[model samples]
Target: MVNEAQEYLADPVLGERVAAELRALLRDPNRLPVLVLATLWPVHWQRLTARRDPDAHAQARALLEEGTRIRVPDSFTAADAHVLAAEGSDPRLRRARECAVNGEITQYLAGVPVLLQRYEDATADARALLDAAIDARRLGWGVDLPTEFLADAASGYLTRAEWDEYGEQWPAPALADTDEHRGGFPGPLTRVRPRRRLRQTAPVDRPACRLADAVEQHGRRSRADTFPAETFWTASLAHADAPTLITLAESARIRGLYRTQMQLLATGALSNADAAAELVNPLTIPALGALGEVSRWAASIVPLTDPGPLARFLRTLHSANQKEAIEVVLARGPGRRAELSNRFGVADLVRRLYDWNHYGRFPESVRSAASAELAALLTRHPDGPTDTGDPKSLARFVNMLEAPAAACATATALRPRSQPDPDPSDAEADEAPETAMVLASRLKRLAEAGNDRALIDLLAEKPARRVAVSDPSGVAHLLRELTRIADTYDVDEVRQLSKRESVTLIADRRPLERVDLTDPTGVALLLGWLNRYHGHWTSWPDRFLHRLEHRRDPLYLSLRDQPYRNAEHLVWQWERAMLGRFATRAAEVALTDARGVADLLNTLSPRTFNYCPQPVAQAALARLLERNPAHHVPLVGASIDGSAAEVLIRALRDAGDPEAASHLQQRAFAAGAYPYLRRSEYRDYGLLPDGTWSPVWTWADMVPSY
Candidate 1:
């Protein structure tokens, strides 16, 4: 089709017709030549332009020359030359000529009339584009123009009414309710409001009087009605409520009004009935079944008054109950009849008893009641040598001795005398070992029962002294038994004793040489002790070094079996200590042994080496150089040698006739070697036989041996 067009254009008649058609289309203000040709022949615009006849080009040039003759603004029409710049059948050339000579030139020749006409045309075009955009937006088809085009067009054509209508019609989901149609309601419409459905009535009946009044009347008279008292008390205890009940209880207790105080105690409306009970219960005769409750009640009350009496009372009750309970078990005598005894002997019961007696005062009823029972037992048993002559019993007797009043008040009592020094000579005069053993056993039971003082007293006895000192297993067993005692219980003395014994045992037992070096726990304990006492003694270094060197064989064996294990850890510790004590020696060791050097170097982190001591740094560097000679020249050239090189120099000098020192110094001064170092200084400080500095041969004077 393109070839047919070209052939036709070559003929005069056909070419003339085609040229006339192109001219007609180009001259029309609304018709474009490219669009006209495209409609007639659906070929590429470039191909269509290339098919333009020679006659068409001549006609276009004539039209442009004619259009230019009409005077026009330079801005209104494209220059005449721009139309004919491209040759051949180019569509751009035709379009350019048409735009210049036709629409633009005609508008420019018409002057201000043309300007107003162009403005009106532009405004009409803008409005049409806006309407098209809005239609697309309404259909949910996105706008196609760039942001600038849309913004410019919208600015020129959008009106206030149009904007309002657009917003109302296209309200976002969140603002849909505020749209014009929704806002046209007669009254305000809230999306959320209280429900209007039938409300369910609560089933609970309302009281006749206010809760406070009802609580006050019914809460005070009966103990069983504690519910109302508890509820009312909680409500009344609020910071905003009146303190009538609290003030009444305080006033009643102060005036010695026992019945009034008891009434307040029964009321339970007060926040502190427990406090009131503690004060009042001791003065009342306790009911049989209520002894335990009454004693606890007294203890709770004691802190509110002089704690002395309450403390004494609580201790008395503890001693009495303990004795009665023990007696009850002993009377049953190691049989099924004593089954109830096991339940009462639990550690929890012992803790409770300890808290009650050791923490607070003795209850008067328990003290008074136990006094008679204790007196009867003492009268039957007496203070003479015990039947078993057991040491455990002697230890118990010693604990009993500390609280003389509790024991002396009994029917059997030790004779009182002037203070006398404890007789060491008369071992026989001391409590018999059998009795002491029995007492120690009982005291241990009491300690297990959480009675720290009883345990201490048992430990102080002659028989217990042997067990405590000579028996490591026995002491460990005892510590395990009392392990629950808090650190605050003055157990530091025992801990110190255990530490001393542990050290002795550790030192006496040789470390297992063939065992795992990965398990440094045994060695770690000794090292930890050394760290703990780092500054206490001067001899510790020798002792530590001796232990480390002696244990080296075992450590080595362990490391051999498990190279990837904590083998590095032990070597690190050894290196740290060596560096601390004999840094030079450590360096020598590292230089001699590759594995030891590697382990030591691994311990030295980059951060530590950043500010390491000059000698230490030099030692490390020398060792590294010896192990890896290739790294030596680059390391020196990098200027990281710093003080380490000087340290290495000094060390080599100290050793007579050092070859390594001479070799390094010679290399440093050689041509093209270590350019980073100062050559003049290197020559000035020459190597000596003793590796010391002596004014020696300069770099210029040295012969090239390499």
Candidate 2:
């Protein structure tokens, strides 16, 4: 029996092997009458069958189609619920019956939430092992985890405390025992086939076991479960063998973990053929640093029609002053361009080379080479149609390159055929726009009636095609109603109205001009909505920043009083704008006012800084340490609250001031405070200022030691 057949088939090597094994079984005349049952998620099955490489998976795809396929109902029937009700004597069964609306009972029947909670209670190393396995499987590394790989990777998950508890027999018996007896009860690991071997693996031999598919499925649905992002995981990956490292690198690339993938490829396990394959894969867009490294591995690989990575690699070389090397690469004859001659691929190569030719970051010599190369490439592949969405942008970029006439003609050919206008009836139905006044009026009436149910229903509906009302009065009225409702209600459903399109229309109208600058609450609400909708912390719209800077009084007021969500959201956005617009304001705020210091320190809190970049906070520290070590350092230290104290302690320890680091360590020991790498970090022993370590804070630390 094969469970999660789709998962097994995702691995290229494993899929071919499965195909071969099945063919052997079919041909055996002496084979016993047998049935093979396999389960597949429709989504994964669709993905596998739709793969572009038909020749590579021809046998596997054919075998899958030849079988008598059966799809189990994803949702439950009424009879199923009645059966659940009959078993209602079991509380879990009763709950499942109650919650099985629209046939989403699979979640309840499988007990996804309960399983996740139980998994959360497991030992850190156990959870780490399970997470790694799930990620590997999800990335097509195969469901059957090798025993040696798990054992080798387990040490990366251990903390200082777990290391001390388990000592040198670190991952062996500890891993097997933890998996078998989590919470002192029999766990999933105890149920693997040949359970006796699980208990009998000696201290010296490699441990062997596989997790149940049910547990892995539960882990997949969990929002919190992920492989450790710490450097330790990368260090562990470096130990992987050539085949494993190559598969793992491919997985990392698909997941957009480019840095991790780069580190994996740098292990020298990737052969020239594998490196060439990686470069040719459209999905494998290497980072600039990775492009340079991968270029070395791909030195002998044939150049294709696509020059994106190669062009980027050449730019890196040029930046590093490798002028002669750039010339050598540019002079290489294009080989095997036939396979990469697709219209989209050639167009992309043209665009990339064109970008390099016009970009100011490249040296003039390199830009000229890029332009010349692009002119030659276009001349060779001038027949394909180019369909650029933005003709003007394409024309501008092409016009700047060396071969303006040929480049412009290529871009013009790429322009898509003009689309016919939509049917009037369908167009009206699809894009029925509503005025902002009407949306705001409807929202205000819903709130005033205090019908939270109706309000939630309205917000849950698909938002209108557009908000016709962009006037300042209409936008303000809409925001005022949203803020008032938000202040009154504490539920998530009501707050979700903030995400709807009508709210976005207000920002589109530029309502900042008319908002009352005196009301900090209104300004805070406006800023929060704008920042949330803007999507990223680093990129605040210039207009939004200008408005805040124009009304500096309110910005300063919000900073002084800690206006919103314990200053978590509003103040965080305010500080981001401050950093963006006025570069030195962070240090000025930290050095001067006590309240500003608290706000600045608050930004360093783990919760806040998780979304925020490190340099923004580090800028303040760098300035504080440089200008006035004695006067301002004490003020900044005095303002450290418990919430933000962890970040400050870590900052001081890493701040390169021996005296400050020593003094901070002593104080942390006295206060039972320790700086950890992550918020989830806990260690038994913390290093001290005097080149020694002591036990970490715990219940035992509260009582006298024996």
Candidate 3:
């Protein structure tokens, strides 16, 4: 085919026909060749003019000369029967029209973009005419015009509303150049109306709290139905029935009105279906459902072919809603495959939860929720998970769960609830092992020489084990006893993720640290053991001494006077003192922020280094706070050394707090309020070998400068 084309074109007989056609076109004297020349990029013309071959360059240069020499048609013609009247309007739009009338394609292309500078600023008629030419060009009818004319015209086309109004301006300008068409321009090119959503105004602009107040006040005198429709429709809502509903949706997103919007949707007060139907076109779906209106929002999701928007929208919904939406996809999505490896983001969620792969990409809260759900999916059905490919192999646990609920109650029995504190006299002895550790020791002891009372207690805790399993003492208790010594793992519970499928590694509301068994803490955690000195303390010491211990530089000079060597005892003392001194205030403060208790705990943290340092103290304080004595002393922010304390105290003072004065007084007392509020003070005293005083400074003056 290639050889044939070359041979046929090369024939002199075919060549002459082409040359005749060229001559006819060149002699025609229409501005089309000039128009086509105008559209050619200057760089392209330069390439041709600068060609190496003389004949080719001459031909290109001639075309260039022809374009330049071609007189731009200054006169005008009537593509439209109407008068070419953009008379007193924008000079640019009028100029565009003059070129259009005269069929001056090159001239029109050159001037259109420059002349019609501002579409919005342009007069209505000017805008309409410009839009008409652009549409007609796009529709492949503006033939007499240059192809580039549409490009310039579109730079300043009619406003959206003008597009529908001007429909088809005139018979398409039939151009002389048959090959020229703006085929690259987008089509189905008729313009639609400006979206009512953009133009409409919401009823109110206040935040939720203020709106709630207003709603409360409004409800006091008149019902929501009786509340003025006029109030909601201050704008000329006439012929704006759909827009009015849209306005309401916008208002509802503003804050307090989310429920109001849902109410409207539920009751059909806004005629949601009608409003949606009215704007069913891709151009008019208003933004919605950001305030967790998901299930209802499902019906109105934009039918955009792109799933990205929908996926992102689903993420912003409430967790329950998010799970529901995922379930929706699982239950009704393509083929309704209820298989475990569905595209429900379950695997991703599971991966995120366990820190399996995503690292910390999802927040801990999200991970916690994902974990709960994955656990539920594993445990929900009696048959257990349907797929082996599940990220969590739930099927293996079917045998474990088949046992009665009593079998699962071992964890609760092992860690008995609400035991009394040990006697203070027992501090030095500290010989009593942890109950779990004791259990471990007892099991070993029993295998050697059984004790009946201990066995009875064990049987009481594990009644299902009275009959015994493989182990004579009961396999369940033996297995449960491993948590005391070997660091075996277990699910916290048969967790119900929701009321769908649903972070505590050990137990609900219990702290968890994954056991390595190699490290001391891990070893102690697993064996329910502690080396008595793990945490023992005596009193709250000065901050300076506390800071030394905090830095891991424990000086005997600091610890020598302390009666207790155990850091744990000191933490125990600090808590008793803290609660005793500030119970009332702490309770009040916890209402506002539980971290207030943590803040107080952190204040003593430097001194409590070995027992309850920051991370450890925070956990302990959290557990203590969770127990909620209903009375905790509000922290004396002024007494704590930080700007946060000052800020808190200042806030209370500004709020006219009575205790603010007392707290400030405490701050003063802490800052050495008395001339000599004496405590035993020790200064470093250098001594010689014979115990005689040494010179303060053989090096420098007493109050020495560096």
Q: Candidate 3's residue-wise lDDT over 240-306, tens digit each? A: 2332344343333221232233333333322333232222212121223132233434424322121
Error of 3 at 384 (Å): 21
Cα distance off (Å), candidate 2, residue 686: 32
TM-score of 1: 0.14
- List clash counts for every candidate, in order: 36, 5, 26
Regions of model 1 farther than 4 Å from truth: 1-410, 413-530, 535-547, 551-706
How much lDDT does each candidate structure score?
0.32, 0.47, 0.31
Top lDDT hit = 2
TM-score-based ranking: 2, 3, 1
Better of 2 and 3 by lDDT: 2
Q: Report the Cα lDDT for residue 641, model 1.
A: 31
TM-score of 2: 0.36
Between prediction 2 and prediction 3, the one with superior TM-score is 2
Between 1 and 3, whose TM-score is larger? 3
- For candidate 2, the lDDT comes to 0.47
Q: Tens-digit lDDT track for model 2 on 533-647? A: 3332223234333444455546445554654553235535664544332223334332333233333344433344433345754564466456542233322222123323344
